[model samples]
Target: MIDKSDVETNVVVITGAAGLIGKAFVRAVAQTGAIVIAADIDLSAAEVVANDLQDLGKVETAYLDITCPKSVDILIADLMDKHGRIDAVVNNAYPRNANYGRKLEEVTYADFSENMNLHLGGCFLIAQKFCAAFKAQGFGNVVNMSSIYGVIAPRFEVYDGTAMTMPVEYAAIKSAVLHLTKYFAQYFKGTGIRVNAISPGGIFADQPKSFLDAYGSRCAGKGMLDPQDIANTLVFLLSDQSRYITGQNLIVDDGYAL
Candidate 1:
């Protein structure tokens, strides 16, 4: 049996809280009485989420640029200082305006490098910092957001007159993140810190209609999995309900891989 009270006062830091999936996670976890720090590159957007959760638990906001080591260090240090201990962290941030829909041939070196840096490098840096804190506190959870593309080939398509395709670089970086999760999980094992990944597929809500319709058609029955679906899974992983699971990737894609 899991005790909700054990986590009631614990602090959870969520990066990319302004993003679709991250916002959902904030809402779900807040209901459990955890103080949530909604961190994002966009402070205004993060503030909106924080305000909405104020009634559930203490909600705070921080501006975090995951690509910068100094930024991550400052945020982590402050959170640890104020809260005394960080119970969990969710690395849900990703580059917003990079070459997302381009193919490998069309992608510039800069584009590929940025994707790798944000997904793999940023995740590594944040995890290392948080693991250090977890070690001191003797308990923590690190949740990395991966994609279905991390484990499978990209399925390209055109929706509502706009072309949509998953890039090779994105897939490559996310794949590396999955392995990184395993590495961190093993390193933190027996130290009370758990590392894991959530690979979401076809999150279309709040997306452009054309993109949603086309992607929806392709996904059909198994195409569009709600952000709430992933959020629920995340809560379980962060909560003691999944205390025994670590170094693993949970795919919540409505069997899209099938």
Candidate 2:
């Protein structure tokens, strides 16, 4: 039997809860009766999100700089003190440098390394600190936000007419996230903690029509997904419905990676 009651009382921390997908995740999770802490680097934006969804469920805003160890540690400590326990954490923060989407040849080594440190490194720090905290508490859940690019080679043809090209750093970070999910799940075996990853395809963000058509041709349906599509999957992972699933990557790309 599903633990619907337990799902209602979950206290989930969603990092980067102010971004496009992050906002949807906050709304979806909040609607499920979980107390959601919408943590983000932009405090005001996160607060706006919280206020907008206040009627949905329990939504709180907190400043979270995933790149900083001190920042990650502080949020964990404060939440533990206030809530007594953190039932789950979604590592959805997307940290990157100014030159993030540069084409392959145009990307500098410094830029690549910096982007890696910001995004992948941030994911690592969050998982490391939170898993340790989960260990002490004896139970927890972790959901890392990866990308479809992580699971398959980039189809550079899709970005042909546009100035857009998949960043190599993104592929590296997200792919690493997939492995990290497996690593944590295996390492924490028998502990009441579970870890998993979500690899979403290109989200509908008003890209050029040419790019959309090109990308759409490769999908089974709806080429570009809405943020809610991914958020729905996240709710499942956080809820008891997916209790026995762990260390797996759920791709919600409308079959783009097919």
Best by lDDT: 2
Model 1 misses residue 125 by how many Å? 1.1
Cα distance off (Å), candidate 2, residue 77? 0.9
The collision pairs in model 1 are 219-223
Candidate 1 lDDT for residue 210: 74
Instruction: Give each model's whole-structure lDDT.
Output: 0.84, 0.94
C-alpha RMSD for every candidate: 2.4, 1.3
Model 1, 1-258: lDDT tens digits are 346675677799999899988889888878778888899999999999888778876778999988788998899899878878899999898863456668668988887777777667888888988899889989999999999889888766534365556777778988998999999999989999999999988786566677766666655375678788898888888887788999999998877675
Worst 10 residues of 1 by lDDT: 156-165
lDDT of 1: 0.84
* RMSD over all Cα atoms, model 1: 2.4
- Candidate 2 has an lDDT of 0.94
How does model 2 score by TM-score? 0.98
